[model samples]
Target: MEAAVSCLAEHGWAGSTVAVVAERAGVSRGAAQHHFPTREDLFTAAVEYVAEERSTALRDLFHAGPAARPAVVEALVDLYTGTLFRAALQLWVAASNEEQLRPRVTELEARVGRETHRIAVELLGADESEPGVRETVQGLLDMARGLGLANVLTDDTARRARVVAQWSRIIDTTLA
Candidate 1:
């Protein structure tokens, strides 16, 4: 699964075959096929693996007391800026063109998005009962995703820091 995520993220959909992933995994192609049965299954499971990692990251942030607004903002942004987001982006693009893969990818993305939003809300101590809080959290996630998209082609680090810092302030004021 790690190999699949890495392969898909680095090499993209056409380049990442089950055989390639199996070789990277140090296993036989037969073994991978036995487990995954199809390319969709393999990639779907790979994305699901990444989603679990994201949930774990958010949980760790909560436990480690990154509940401080800046820390939470940075951590949430970090989630999209990393390899997992790249892998998922590749899947999303493939799913866009592939009729067979669209529904599964769409459903998985919805689940991951919802779970991430839930965790982000908790870590940020967001009061969803109040007006606009839910939208605010969703906007933060959407903004993070845009940052991740901006990161794909170039070194968005310096600029991303500025954006993150500004967004942190926005969240602080808006949520305060």
Candidate 2:
């Protein structure tokens, strides 16, 4: 699964063939085929694998202590704008053009989105029933996604930091 994620992250969807993943994993093609008979199957499993890993990390963070909202926001930003999001973006683009992969990708995306929202709400200690709290969470996720997209074209470190700082302030004011 790590091999598959690495392939998608580095090569994009079209280039991340099962054979390449097998080679990168140091496993025989037959072995990879035995586990995933189709490209869609392989990529979907990879998506789930990464999501599970991330969700676990988020849960651990939640258990650690009461983190400051800005720290939580920065952590969430790092999570969204990192390798997993890049790999998922590759799959999303490919799935748009590939009919066979669309259903699985779409389903996985929905599940991941829900889990991400839940994690954000918990991390922020924000009451979803409160006015604007849910929207604020959604906004944060959208902002992170947009930043990740911008990161694909160039180094967006300075811009991303500025945006995150501003957004963190907004979140504080909204939740206060």
Candidate 3:
């Protein structure tokens, strides 16, 4: 699955075949097919696998103790700037053109989005009961995704950090 994610992240949906992923994982194509009968099965499972891992990682980071709001905000943004996001973006692009992949991708994205929102709310100490508070947190996620899209072409590190820092302040003021 890790190999599949890496393949998708680096080469995208068109280039990331089960055969290539098997080669990357040092396994035979037949063995790869044994686990994932089809390409859709492999790629969907791959993105879902890494998304779960990333969520667990985020929770583990904050499990030791409470982090500052800025740190939490930065971590939230970091979710969109890595391998999982890139791999998932490829799936989204494929899903756009492929009718067979569309429904699965839509469901997967909704599940991932809800889970991420829940994690962000918990980690950021966000209060959803308050009006506009939920949107504030969602805004953070939407902005982070936009930054991720911007990062698809070139390194947006310096600018992304600035945006995250500003977002930290915005959330502190708005969500407070």
Candidate 4:
């Protein structure tokens, strides 16, 4: 799994193969096949593992307290740009090319979106039916995704930091 993560990060979904993963792991192709019968299975496991890691990080940061919300949001923005979003982008590109991976990718996306929505609700203490809360959260998510893509295309730390700051202000003002 660690080898898979490193290979996926290095070569991306299209370039990464079970053979490559096994080679990176210093395991035989037969062993890799024994563990993951199909590429879809491996991709599914990778997505699930990454999602779990991302959810844990966000949960830990957000659950710290109201005093830590800004830091949490900033860290989330950084994460979105650095890892989760990049992996998702690779998955998205792979999903476009491979029909077998589509359902797994979609499932992972929905799980992450649901988790993010839940966290936003908890942070804002906002009702799901509230007028502005959902919209604000959605906007924040959209911005994060966009900023993440931008970060990937250009190593723009200052711009990403600005976006994080703006997102924090929006969340704070809405909650206030």
TM-score top scorer = 3
Candidate 3 residue lDDT tens string, 72-105: 9999889999888999999999999999999999
TM-score for candidate 1, residues paired by index:
0.97
Clashing pairs in 4: none
For candidate 4, give the lDDT of residue 48.
Answer: 69
User: On a 0 to 1 TM-score scale, where does candidate 3 land against the true structure?
Assistant: 0.98
Off by over 4 Å in 1: none
The lDDT of each candidate is: 0.92, 0.88, 0.93, 0.74
Model 4 lowest lDDT segment of ten:
64-73
lDDT of 4 by residue, 1-176 (tens): 76676677667987888999899889999999998998777866876687678777767766656645577567656657765567668887788788888878888788878887677667656566767778877777777778888877779788777768877887877855
Scored by lDDT, model 4 comes in at 0.74
Each candidate's TM vs. the true structure? 0.97, 0.96, 0.98, 0.86
Cα distance off (Å), candidate 4, residue 91: 1.1
The order by descending TM-score is: 3, 1, 2, 4
What candidate 4 gets wrong by more than 4 Å, as runs, is none
Residue 136 error, candidate 3, Å: 0.9
Each prediction's RMSD over C-alphas, in Å, is: 1.0, 1.0, 0.8, 2.1
Native RMSD of candidate 1 (Å) = 1.0
